[model samples]
Target: MSVNESNPRQLKLLAAVRERGAATVEELAQLLDVTLQTVRRDVQRLAEAGLLARFHGGVRVPGSTTENIAHGQREALNAEGKSRIARAVAGEVPNGCSLILNVGTTAEAIARALLRHSGLRVITNNLNVAGILAANAQCEVIVAGGTVRSRDRAVVGETAVDFMRQFRVDIAVVGCSGIEADGTVRDFDLREVKVAQAILAQGREVWLAADASKFNRLAMVQLAELSRFDRLFTDAPPPAPFPDLLERAQVRCVVAGADATGDPTP
Candidate 1:
């Protein structure tokens, strides 16, 4: 295989990492039906090119940056993927159910998808989500009280976390900056993480929504583990170890539709 960016093998490697979130050398080799050395070399080239991140034993889609991405940039990152994920997640949530939505572009997408649903009591830390749901008179939108971060219109602080503990909802839809290979969810801000944590805790069934770009990104705080989610909805399948890890964790991964490689729709 040509070890360049245009090489089919390299492209496949990137896609696999993005799907699975992360994959070890052995896992990548098996997935590509290539030798371990070839996988390593491809990973090395991709890492050097700034397309992926190489860790101790595997490669993952690179995280955007050490800091949080600007809200506008995040909305533009994987617009279609987030839309697909939101639709899939929305399918699982019935009308008239109580929900807690954390702050993120993907979470905002979920809110948009839920606009047609009636009798939804949405508790959210995102002003954007609140505004979208508020337009639907049938839906009761509850905004968390806290210091609003102007960058993303996210409400965070002790008050937000405390507010989240007041009600146990039917579902929790959350987004993350990154997903670790070992099933850990990540975020850049500690305050946001706290509110996310509280939201996760208050939901009976947790669903994590993220686009393929979220795989392999590094965030400063660990929000929760993949095990905490009852289901993970995304635009594509996750990498090797994640399939096994999700199985062990009993977390179902719902693919939105035909993936980039023309994989069959779910």
Candidate 2:
């Protein structure tokens, strides 16, 4: 069967791979209630189209720059945790100030949280964030000009990086795909990482917002070390060496819905 057919089985297969990160052929067959042969055929087609990857025993979703899931999928990944993190971050931002934001689902959540604040200037490379904040007439939204990635509406490349160099803001809001044990933040796209780096450099104080799942994930490009951020808002405390690293770096860590080292509550 064709991968682009939009049939129920193929769609379900895609969803399954996205949910589990990776799946064996047998797993997909059972999960989709399809024959092993049918599963293999569908996997072959999807892999050919660069939607997924083929390994010895299974097919896996592509976590690389080109094949990452749509923004909508990311928004649904950790909805509640992101919202809480957003609220905490919103509390940290004042009514009248300049802020820089970058591309990521968590950054989008922050945009929604900032809607009520007035007299704020927001510069971003995320088209989604620009749109979400544009509704606030009091908040000035500045979008970077660059190559707009069709898959996720993320603005990246050198133009985006250069665009971010013009301002030193009060705070920077950013997100990443993974947080390493060494306290490094990482993402799958090097181009996007460059833009993030530029944004970080232009901000007086940087705030990183990521869900706990990032602790267990890995990505190809390094954004920055946790030391670069003044504060980190997350759903849970990081595991292992990270806790000590953050303490040493003096980075305030805010855990959503829980009291921790950096709770923003009054």
Candidate 3:
């Protein structure tokens, strides 16, 4: 096929990369039906455009890359509030249960709470969670192997979804980038939704843990219907159509301990 300039071959290549979850030059060449040299040229151009990440002989989704941050840095940002919310979520997980934790900063807090518990198996795509649990002697933590999105340290793509289906989880603890009055779950990265959906399939119950900021904004992908989740944990009461929507969807809303002041907040 001839490449189009307005929506050029590089764009097509990036879209294809997003779809196939491929991370290398070889994989891109095979998928695009081009030569290695051509793939290299396309890749170089895409890299220059900030549309793709160049790895050794491969590429990765820019926003989904896994990362490591010092505990001090994480703790400094809303530490006490996140800790309370995490503790509340941890109470929901009984001993001897399997859970799927999504890749989000808030969900990382929940995973932190889980680190103190025993006999709980957590399958996750969050590198932050995985690392925390690695030091814990109590919980069994399994990382979903796939291309790591360095930006968020979220494991994503076909391989991650494929691995998630191997076992069922008692609960899937997830964080959404945004929420709608209609009870829709949203995220900017559509590929991450594929991984989230897979995790949903494995869980008997789905709990969405979102901060107040998730309201109003719209994330690009809808991982699943809000009705699919059994519970929604948030720092404050939902606004407007949110309550009605969640009621219609039959999702129980659990508000965390108000806000930092122990009063009602978003």
Candidate 4:
């Protein structure tokens, strides 16, 4: 089922599984305050859509390294978390600065959050982001030339990479399909990975905008390492080993809507 067809309960169910890595039918039913039959139905639908994997009596996120979930489903997954991450990233952006926003639903959300900022120049490979920022009169939006992937309206390929190399910007706000346990940031598309790498190289400071769902998730193509980022903006505290990893990498972690201020590492 498409994300549009998924009810609020299904989305909540998905979030719960993501947080815990797996959940039984009884656990989901209790957590969602729904009947066992209802929980089973939701799990079936989500699993059918490749968003979850069904076992004998429970569901877990699908472990697919070569394929990503549908674009629509990804846009709806952990939406509130993505919004919080957007706001936190926007909070750090100054009024006047240049930044490159790469492809992802979170990057599109960040574009919306940046609409009120003035005297900003934004470059993006995602058509959705360019359209959102276009409404902001003060922000100059530049679109990169490349082969557009119709699935997500993302411009990828070597042309996009060459286009990004044309200018160095203040910050690169990037999103990834997954972040592995070994601190590798990954994506499903090699073309997109090349463009993202170019965007990273062109930025004076790089900030990674990802929701908690991305942590420990697996994707096939390696985009970059966690150590490459100057900051990580997320909705909740990262799970075990990440806090220590970020500390060693000197990458400031910002837990949005939390007490930590994510100040620059001295």
Candidate 5:
């Protein structure tokens, strides 16, 4: 089934598993206030769609090193978290500055959040991001020239990498398919990785925008190390090792959707 066809319960189920990392059949049933059979059915459907990975008794977010989730599924997954991350990133972005946004659903969300900002120059390799930011009259949107990936309207390859080298931006906002325990950021496509690396090289400061679901997940191509980023914006505090990793890397971690006192919402 398409992501749009997923019911509210299914979405909630996904959120529960995402927040907890994993949940058993009984746990999910109780959390959703549904029968065990119903939860099983939903899990089966979501697992079949590659939105979740099923083990003997529970489900968790998929952890495929060689393949990223489908674009639509990724958009639907952790959507609220992505929005929070976007807002946090946007809050830090100064007006009248130039930035490069790489390809991802989260980057598209950031584009939407940036609509109100004026006198901004935004360069992107994602068509969706370009389209979203195009509505902002005050923001100059530049699209890189390259072969577009039909899956998510991302422009990648050597041409895109070359296109990004033309300017040194104030910040590069990027997302990854996964962040490993060893502090390696990763993605599934080598061409996309190359383009992202180029974008990072051109930025005076680099920021990573990703949801908590990406923690400890796996992806094939090594994008960059966590140390490369100056900041990390996400919805929740990262699990163990990452806090130490970020501290060592000297990357500031900003938890969005936090209370006014600056504590993460429970």
Candidate 6:
């Protein structure tokens, strides 16, 4: 369906999310007196615009009048999608391996997969990730301490940079706020970008774990060109020139659809 076909429902869903903070498909279906599938379509459309995040069972109001967003809400959006990416990433690791996971929402999903591995060494600046892995007796988790951003919920600063330099890893699974046709990986904040570069520098194999929303959008800062990546694992195929551009850059673009079990949505 075209944007025009979905715009009205999108706006209504957006308002509903704003008023209630968040709403599940079932709730929206009841409120709008429509099929749950109709609510899903509206949610997917708004999500593509980056106006709202698609959650597991619902959608969250993006940004806010009184406060910024948190990780708790984002974890719901594409829950199965994230899990698919996580299991794929985990499958790449051996029994004893060291890896760097950047502090991004998708990266968080990858971290969850790491929990299933035994005798693993993990490096990250994300306090949430470090805390989550601490419970696994078979895994060793390292934290790069630095100033914390409550709004973004990640640790970043010069201290984090210095800490990252101390170790080398087999893989670095980072996140991108946005990706351009030119294969430039961007992030919303300069501080975050700077830290991501540090993580990339410490690893030989750089695996960027992202969903399809990351494509065609440019974050405020461009940290690395697409050529720097060894593998790009995203949830779906990118629009237009980006796919061609990534190929030209010699970057391996491996697309795993959000619904990996099925083909890409038309």
Return the top candidate by TM-score: 4
In the range 31-65, model 3's lDDT, one tens digit per residue, is 77889998887776555544457878887655632
Q: Give residue 159's lDDT in candidate 3 (0 to 100).
A: 93
Name the runs in model 4 displaced over 4 angstroms.
1-49, 258-266
**Cα-lDDT of candidate 5:** 0.86
How well does model 3 score by local distance difference test?
0.71
Model 4 agreement with the true structure over 1-266: per-residue lDDT tens digits: 43335554675687778768899999999999999999998887778667789989999878778988877877876676677778788888999999999999999989988888999999999999999999999999999999999999999999999999999999999999888778999999999999999999999999998877677777899999999999998877777678888999999998886332322222
Per-model TM-score on C-alpha atoms: 0.76, 0.74, 0.68, 0.84, 0.83, 0.73
For candidate 4, the per-residue lDDT at 101 reads: 98
Find the 10 residues in a row with the least total lDDT in model 2.
257-266
Q: What is the C-alpha local distance difference test score of candidate 6?
A: 0.73
In order, what lDDT does every prediction score? 0.81, 0.80, 0.71, 0.86, 0.86, 0.73
Q: What is the C-alpha RMSD of each candidate to the true structure, in Å?
A: 6.8, 7.6, 14.6, 4.2, 4.2, 8.5
Model 4 / residue 114 / CA error / Å: 0.7
Better of 2 and 5 by TM-score: 5
Candidate 2, overall lDDT? Answer: 0.80
lDDT of 5 at 203: 94
Q: After superposition, how far is residue 233 of candidate 3 from its true place, in Å?
A: 0.4
RMSD of 4: 4.2
lDDT of 1: 0.81
Worst 10 residues of 4 by lDDT: 257-266
Total clashing pairs in model 3 = 12
